[model samples]
Target: MMSISSRFAVGIHILSLIEFNKDGISSSEYLAESVNTNPALIRKIIGMLKKAGLVEVHPGIAGTKLARQLSDITLLDVYKAVNVVQKHELFSVHENSNIKCVVGRNIQDTIIPILSTAQSALEKVLENVTIEDIVKDITEKENLDKRHS
Candidate 1:
C-alpha cells in the first residue's frame, strides 16, 4: 500500500477548524479532540504551521488561530509549509533489477526524468488549489453528513 503523509490533511483540518471558529484561539486540547490525535502531535503540527506563516499563536491562555485569510493560502503553500515530500518521486526502485535484462540495467536512470516530470505535474495541480477550496469541501461534506443524519 502506498503511504501518504498526514501533515497536509492535518494542517488543513487544523486551519479549517480555526477558520470555522472565527479567530477563536483554539487550544491544543480542543484541536486534539477534533483531530482524534494526541495533544503533543497537535502542538507539533501547530508549530510547523506557525513557522510556515499559516497560523499564529497567542501565548499564555489564548492558544492559536489562522494568521491570514484562507483564500490567500494555497494547498501547495500548506503542503510545503507542513513539510510534505516535495520534488519527490512517488516510488523508487532501491534494488537493482537484473543487469542482464536490457531494461532493468537502465530503468532507474530512465525513470528519474519521468519521475521528475510527474512530480512537477502533481505540484502544478497542487499550486492551483487553495485552502479556501479545502474549507469549502469540508463544509460541503459536513452539510452532507448533517442532511443524511
Candidate 2:
C-alpha cells in the first residue's frame, strides 16, 4: 500500500516547533535539529510550506514562522503543502496490468472508486484536525503523563 509521504509529517513538525517557540525565529538549522534531519531537507519542506502559504520565511533574519493562526491550519492544509501525490490520492494503482486478465482489465474501474472514497474519508478526518487541536492534544497528554509520574 502506498503511504503518505514523510514530508507531510516533517512539515507539521516544523510548524509545531514554530508554534511552540513563537518567541524565537525558526531557522532551517533549528528546524532540522528538532526534526533530526539535514538542513537541506528542512529547507525543502519549508519551501513547500511557504508555497502553500502555511509558513513565512524572512530573508533578513534567515528564519521562519507560521503564516496564520494555528486554529486556521488544518492537517489537510499541511498534507497538501508537502504531498506531491496527484489530487491527494493516497493509493497508486498498479500500472501495466495485463489486458488479457479479467481482474486486470476491470481493476481500474473497480478500484478507482473505492480508492477515491477512501481518500475522501481521509480528507474529511484531516479537515477536522487543525494544528491547534494537535498542539492541545500534545500538551494535554504531556500534562497527564506528568501528573501520573
Candidate 3:
C-alpha cells in the first residue's frame, strides 16, 4: 500500500515547531536538529511552505515562522506544500500493462477513479484538522504524560 510521503510529516513537524516557538526564530539548522535531518532538507521544505504562503522566512536571521495563524493552516495545506508527488495522485498505476490483456488494458482506467476517491476522502479529513488542533493535542498529551510521571 502506498503511504503518504515523509515530506508531508516533516512539513507538519516544522510548522508545529514554529507554532510552538512563535516568539522565537526557527532557523533551518534548528529545525533540522529537531527533525534529525539535514539543514538543506529543512530549507527546501521551508521554501515550499513559503511558496504556498504557509510560512515566511527571515533572510537576515535565516529563520522562519508561520505566515498565518495556526488555526488557519490545515494538514492539507502542508501536504500540498512539500509533497513532490502529483497532487491527489496517491496511488501510482503500473505503466507497463500489456494492452492485449483484458485486465491490464483496463487497469489504469479502472483503478484511477477509486484512488482519486480515496485521496479526496483523505483530503477532506485533513482539511478539517488545523495546526492549532495538532499543537493542542500535542500539548495535552505531553501534560498528561508529565502528570503520570
Candidate 4:
C-alpha cells in the first residue's frame, strides 16, 4: 500500500540532531543509537545524505558534519534525496469497466483533468515547506516546552 518511501523523516532526525550540537562529532554508531536502528542502516542513510550534498563525512579521524547551513536546506531537498517517487500515478484504474456502461467508458477521461489538478495542488503545498522552517518550528516548541517544565 505504501507508494512513496518517506526517508525525509529519518533525514530530518539526523539533521535535527546535528543542528542541536555545535561541534559534537557524531559517528554512524551514535546516530544508529539515536534512531534505534542498525549501524549499517544509519550508515546507508548517511551515505544518501552525503550523496545529496547535505552532509560531509571525514575519513581517518574527524566525523560527519552538516555540509550546508540548516536554514539554507529545504525540506524538499532532503525529501528528494530519500524519497523513491512512484513513476506512475498512485492508482491505475486503467482497465475499462464496460463500454456499454457509458459511465465506465468515460470515467477515466473525465477524471484525468481532476486528477492532474489535484496532483499539481498537492505539489505546490509540498513546495511551500522547507527543512529550515521545520527545524525552526521544532526549536520553538522545544524551547516552549522546556520553559514550562
Candidate 5:
C-alpha cells in the first residue's frame, strides 16, 4: 500500500515543537534534535511551512516561530502546507486497464467517486483538528507520564 509522505508528519512535529518550546529558540538544529533527523530536513520542511504562512523563520539564532495562533491553524493547514498529497490526488486510479474487460473498463469510473468522498472525509477530520488540540494532548500526556513516574 502507498503511504502518505512523512513530510506531513514532520511538518506537524515542527510546529508543535515550536509551540511546545516557545520559551526556547526553535532553530533548525534544535528541531532536528527533537525530530531525530537532519537539520537540513527540518529547515526544508520549515521553509514549506513558512511559504504557507504557517511559520516565520528568523535570521541568526532567533530561530522559527508560528506565524498564526494555534487555534487558527488546523491540521488541514499543516497537511496542505506540507503538500503531503498533490491537488485532488489523494487516491490514484490505475490507468489503461483493459478496455475489453467489463470490470477493467469500469473500475476507474466506479472508484473515483468513492475515492473522492473518502478524501473529503479525511480532510474534514483534519480541518476540525487544530494545533492547539494536538499540543494540549501532548501536554496532558506528558503530565500523566510525570505523575506515573
Candidate 6:
C-alpha cells in the first residue's frame, strides 16, 4: 500500500516552528536543522507553501512567516499546499487489468466508491483540524514532559 508523502508532516513542522519562534528567524536552514534534512528540500517545500498562500517568503531575507493565522490554516490546507497526493487522490487503482477476466474488469468499478468514501472521510477530519489545534497539543505535551522531568 502506498503511504502519504513526508512533505505533509514537514510542512506542518515548518508552520509550527514559525509560530513557536515568531519573534525569531525561520529560514530554510533553521527549519532543516529541526527536520534533519537539507536546506534545499526545506526551501522546496516552503516554496510550495508560499504558493498556496500559507506562507510568505521574502527574497534575500533570513526568514519566512505564516500568511494567515494559525486558526485559519487546516491540515487539509497544508496537505494541498505540499501536493501530498496527486490530483487529490489518496488511493490509486491498478490499471491495464485484462478485460477478458471478470474480476479485472469489475474491480476498478467495485472499489472506486469505497475509495472515494474513505478519502472523503479522511479529508473531513483534516478540514476540522487547524494548525492552532496542533500547536495547542504540542504545547500541552511539552508541558507534560517538563512536569515529568
Q: List the global CA lDDT of all models.
A: 0.83, 0.87, 0.89, 0.75, 0.91, 0.93
Better of 1 and 3 by lDDT: 3
Candidate 4 regions with alpha-carbon error over 4 angstroms: 59-62, 87-117
Q: Pick the candidate with the highest TM-score.
A: 6
Error of 1 at 64 (Å): 1.4
lDDT per residue as tens, model 4, 1-149: 55556466888888878777657878878887888888788778778889999999865655578899877777667766765543235445577578888898899888877777776576566667766777789899999999999
- Candidate 6 residue spans exceeding 4 A from truth: 98-105
Pairwise TM-score winner, candidates 1 and 2: 2
Every candidate's CA RMSD: 3.0, 2.3, 2.1, 3.3, 1.8, 1.7
Check candidate 6 and list the clashing pairs.
none
Q: Once superposed on the true structure, which residue ranges of model 5 sit more than 4 Å away at CA?
A: 59-61, 97-107
- Residue 45 local lDDT, model 6: 97
Task: List the candidates ranked by lDDT, beginning with the highest.
Answer: 6, 5, 3, 2, 1, 4
**lDDT at residue 78 of model 3 (Cα atoms):** 87
Candidate 3 per-residue C-alpha lDDT over 1-149 given as tens digits, one digit per residue, 9 for 90 to 100: 66667998999999999988878879999899999999999999898999999998867776797899999999989888886557756777779899999998999988899999998998899999999999999999999999999
Q: What pairs collide in candidate 2?
A: none
The list of candidate 3 runs beyond 4 A from truth reads: 96-105
The true-versus-predicted C-alpha distance at residue 98 of model 5, in Å, is 5.3
* Best model per lDDT: 6
State the displacement of the C-alpha of residue 7, model 4, in Å, after optimal TM-score superposition.
1.7
Q: By TM-score, highest first, what's the ranking?
A: 6, 5, 3, 2, 1, 4
Q: Which of the two, 1 or 6, has more lDDT?
A: 6
Tens digits of per-residue lDDT, candidate 1, 12-131, equal 888888888775658998888999999889998888888988888855756787788889988787888888685475656567689999988998888888888887788889899878
lDDT of 6 by residue, 5-110 (tens): 9999999999999999999999999999999999999999999999999999989998999999999999999988999886536788898899999999899999
Better of 4 and 6 by lDDT: 6
